[model samples]
Target: MRARLLDATLELLVERGFAGTSTTLVSERAGVSRGAQLHHFPTKNALVVAAVEHLTERRGAELSAAFEELGAEPVATAADRRTRLRAVVEMLGDHFASPVFTAALELWVAARTDEALLAAVAPLEQRVGRETHRLTVAALGADESRPGVRELVQATLDLVRGLALASTITDDSARRRRILREWADVLDRELGKELTA
Candidate 1:
């Protein structure tokens, strides 16, 4: 029943914005009796909190798995850089259609007014950043824990965020591709000497 309510809330959260998603709707969509939902969540806020946790757990695993898979690929040496680079770029690029990011945007908006949701998401965000740092270091074979990698990682992340926000309203994949191409340029410039020809 708890699982049903959370799954329903996630679906509604994607369709309706945070304020628009309601406990009643969740129960209806879940086909869980109202009594069962109330027994689990007790309030709309509690249900939303569960939704936040649901997204956080799912997305954290998704990202970690993606990066882990990227690292796990065969890249015997620096001569293999282009292959590894393209694979990493494509992996990050796949986030453009990611339902997880869409759900996260909804969770981000809900967190603005919901302290519990914010609290639940904050640590997850930190863990994600750290995990990203580790993956960058592994991919670049540099101490990306240092300041230089911070700039590169944060810049790339910000570009992705800007594009993700735009992606919600702007239904143009060409525009999205253009935005990422520009980002690839920035990365190229920043990594010029280090790209190892």
Candidate 2:
């Protein structure tokens, strides 16, 4: 029941943004009664904030699962390393372009003007950002203790996020693919230099 409400809230958030989504709408979408929805989440802010947190956890798990499925074979050659790195970059880009990101963006936009929502969202965003950075480092098999590697990983995340934002305005698929590919090459070279130095 709670899961259903949260899922519906996420769908509505992506479809209608925070201002348009209401508890009534969420109840109807979830096929759960208003009473039940209220019983679980007493306010719209509670419902939406919980939904974001739930979606973030789910998305993070999905990313970890996807990364695991990418195979753990040793990179025996430079070509193999490049291929693996490119796959990671592509995966990260796809993640940022997903509906979860769209839904989160809606909350972020709304939170900018709503002090209460901002209070709720700020810590959540920090936690999500840190988790994402950690996951990216793990996915890339990066040692952040090395100089410049941490900043490079952060830049990769920022790049993907910016690409995701651009995609919200229009079909940025072709350009995104090109940019990700170029960025992947840059990562490979930079990380390779760090590894060998």
* Candidate with maximal lDDT: 2
Candidate 2's displacement at residue 80, Å, is 0.9
Flag clash pairs in model 2. none
TM-score of each: 0.82, 0.94
Q: What is the C-alpha lDDT profile of model 1 across 89-133, one tens digit per residue? A: 556656634767777788888777778888986777677667666
Superposed model 2: Cα runs more than 4 Å off = none
The 10-residue segment with the lowest total lDDT in model 2: 58-67
* CA shift of 43, model 2, Å: 1.5
Runs in model 1 lying further than 4 Å from the true structure: 69-71, 74-79, 139-142, 145-147, 195-197
Q: Roughly what TM-score does model 1 have, to 2 decimal places? A: 0.82
Tens-digit lDDT track of model 2 for 82-161: 99899999998988898889988998998999898888788888988898899788878788999899999999999999
